[model samples]
Target: MRVAVAEDGALFRQGLVLLLEAAGHEVVACEAGGDPLVAQLSTIPADVALLDIRMPPEPDGGLVTAERLRDAHPDMGLLFLSHYAESHYLMRILEIGTDRIGYRLKEKVGSVDVLSDTLTRIADGEIVIEPELAKRLVERPRSEKRDLVASLSERERDVLKLMAEGRSNNGIASTLFVSAKAVEKHVANIFDKLGLHADTSAHHRRVQAVLTYLRSQRGDA
Candidate 1:
């Protein structure tokens, strides 16, 4: 796949270019900030661009840049690269409203094969979310709880917290030291309380619950 990378650090930019090339993918452009990327975006035949959350002038300039680029190049897939797991950044990125996108920690780029596969998946119109964001969702403080989460009872809230963490019924049961049957009941109750019954898709309910949880934390929902 053809790729473009936008990162502020010179070493990291070159390293990413090299890594993509070594993995048998083309690196069309490796820019330091959003302006250069916008200048080159239309002309370059790149499939996806990996943007860092912090770049040029301010810390979250890239988020705005991604929004602009998404409007200009809706077909182009975008991936956000972050230094640490910040759920607020993920929530803000989602607000820009683009699909075929992803948010992952810089630490996730450890393996060449994984990076190559991730780029391929994103370019193929997939939403590749990082697991860290899931954990970050549930780890949010109680003072941050909003209407959606505030409505849930304590046990149901515990289930929702683990659910946002991507824990399975069995996994949550083990964590809570409850029976799997009890965990199943909790999961159903969670879906009911969150009003997530509309979708029959395999992961729709889970995704909705988690996004709601995170958006509540960001105070956007």
Candidate 2:
């Protein structure tokens, strides 16, 4: 596969290039920042674009570039590499409505096979989420429900899981085989029961829920 990498850190960028090239994929272009990458995009049609979530000029410049690239080439696969898997970042990528999107943590980059598999999956039009993220997505709401799960309806707990997974109301409906309106009511109930309705971004809510969940799991262990 033809790939392009956009990352501001020289060492990390070079290490990625080495990894991808050694794995037998062509590294068509590598850029230090997003602007050069945007310029390079005009000349090169990449099969998959690997981008760092944080880049120069802005913290989310890579996300901005990904959005632009998606607009210009809707079919192109895009993968975001980050040190931390922020819920807001995942939410923004999903908002783009592209099936060929992936979110991976940098620590996992040590495994060439994993990285290659992720790239191939994205290229094949599958959404590839890291296992840790997936675990967090499932566990987040269960933790929040510890004090209230007994009182809350089963549907409310389901809604909370889907929300932590960064699903929209429509997504939760489809997944749960319920109507969007029903999902909406469940989400509202969840917020009310959990007291998570005020003074927090959706990003913060999801992160907090996931962290709480993970901590609980550790305590259980």
Top-scoring candidate (TM-score)? 1
lDDT of each: 0.74, 0.74
lDDT by residue (186-217, candidate 2, tens digit) is 87676677655545765455445444543343
Model 2 residue runs over 4 Å out of place are 142-221
Candidate 1 RMSD to the real structure: 5.3
Clashing pairs in 1: none
RMSD of 2: 8.8
- Clashing pairs in model 2, backbone N/Cα/C closer than 3 A: none
Superposed Cα deviation of residue 160, candidate 1 (Å) = 8.1
**Reference-based lDDT, residue 3, model 2:** 95
Query: How far is each candidate from the true structure, as Cα RMSD in Å?
Result: 5.3, 8.8
